[model samples]
Target: MPTRRYDNSPGLGSLYARTVKATLRKAEYEPDTDGLTLELPRALVDQDHLTAYREVTGFSAGPALPVTYPHILAFPLHLDLMSDPSFPYKPMGIVHLANTITQLRPIPMHAELSIKVHSGPERPHPKGTVFDILSDVSVDGEVVWNDTTTLLSRSPGTPSAHADLLPDPCLEARAFWDLRANLGRRYAAASGDRNPIHLFKLSAQAFGFPRQIAHGMWAKAAALASIQRARALPDAFTVRVDFRKPLLLPSRVQFAHTITDAATDFAIYNDDTTITHLIGQLVAR
Candidate 1:
């Protein structure tokens, strides 16, 4: 299949509108037999976007960009692929189940990056079906950042793929925060992910959420930011996060971690109930 190329990242406003229309149409979309690849020209990270992202996630500004930064760069392509007529599922209802990001090396802020995104074939899952959206960022032909984001779409008639497992509560929280309702909107604005489910109470209600919910990536980034503040992290490492429950807007949550020589195990939970919202680990590479 021919690789789709874009001269510039599509505007988030247009992408979100088109995705909503596609979801409402519910056209008989088909998955690409051989999958799809999207490539974009060499681009520089925007200083304003970086500043906003850092302010929202608590990441410090430095010569190197955060490991998850490229994920934002690749997001528009992910949306484009999902909104394609040949894509198998609607963009709205699909759940972001998990994400793993590996930084092969530190990426300099001045380096120009070429981003490529691939939407892989769907495979049977206990809930219904799941697929991988893989993204890679390269500088001068060498891949410096890689990410795999897994999404699940539930089918009413399909049998569950596996038993649901809840993560055990961490012994205690090392830090806590009262996340505001506007957090989702802030993160969306910085990340270019304008999914309605995370935007506002009214928009979320349309998608069956009681209130606006935080973005999983935002939660993960916040946790990383907290951890990085406490200590230095390896230049090359992998961070994997499993999103267990939605973090409702304007909520209080605790961050916990257990550090070892190889990796740091972390979890975010409701400060009052101890319910796990996300479980993850950061392993030195």
Candidate 2:
């Protein structure tokens, strides 16, 4: 493994510009067995950005940051890794299949963090090759938050070493969110994930989407925020979510959940229940 350090975070606009070229210029389709890691040894949260994130993700204003907030901080690292010339595949069109977040402790608003994002060995998947983009946040050398985003590169099918996913939870609607068309733009401004598919209908149409879609992470965060309204999450917990469907923008969605002694099972569904946007389980660790 090789570690690359950044004196300053790379610009998302530039990274996206490179993404178009990466898509046109082909790369090997093999697994990334020789790992790569990117580190930001010193990073601070911006209150303004955090506030904007809170507003968009439905989190409250508080000193303790939202559990998913650090993902935004590590997002640029994800792009940079994929944008790297040595990376095995093009930076665009990778599917975010699943995500798992382990919160060791609630991070404070102003705590300085050492953030790291790394590429793990690619694994077998039914649709194609899958890999983990891992990121973590450390405060004073102790990691407080870590997340694994499982992404898929569509290709030939292969037997996976992984086990079957958990059975889908049964649940009822908890509430509804009227997500506007600009939801993606607002969230991108707050989070720096200016993926065109999430930003404009025309751009998304270029990629075969009928319209702009919501960010999977935003759906996850909004679900957590809805849960927090009824029951505060345990300080230390792990949230595992499978992104089942893309939520098209300007849509009304049903949010549902069932809380238990062991965990909280939740989901986001299309208004009519024909499509499940996401399914997730959060357990106190």
lDDT of 1 by residue, 1-285 (tens): 758988888777777777878777765746565767889867789988899999999999899897778899899888887777667787778989999999999999878999998887777777778888999999999998999999988776256456343356355788888999999999988998877889999999998999999999998898888888888778999999999999999899988888879788889989875588998989999
Question: After superposition, which runs of candidate 2 have C-alpha atoms over 4 Å from their true positions?
Answer: 28-32, 159-164
Model 2 Cα RMSD, 1 decimal: 1.7
TM-score per model over all chains: 0.94, 0.95
List residue ranges in candidate 1 displaced over 4 A: 26-29, 157-160, 163-169
Clashes of each: 5, 0
Pairs with backbone N, CA or C atoms under 3 Å apart (clashes), candidate 2: none
**Predicted structure 2: lDDT:** 0.89
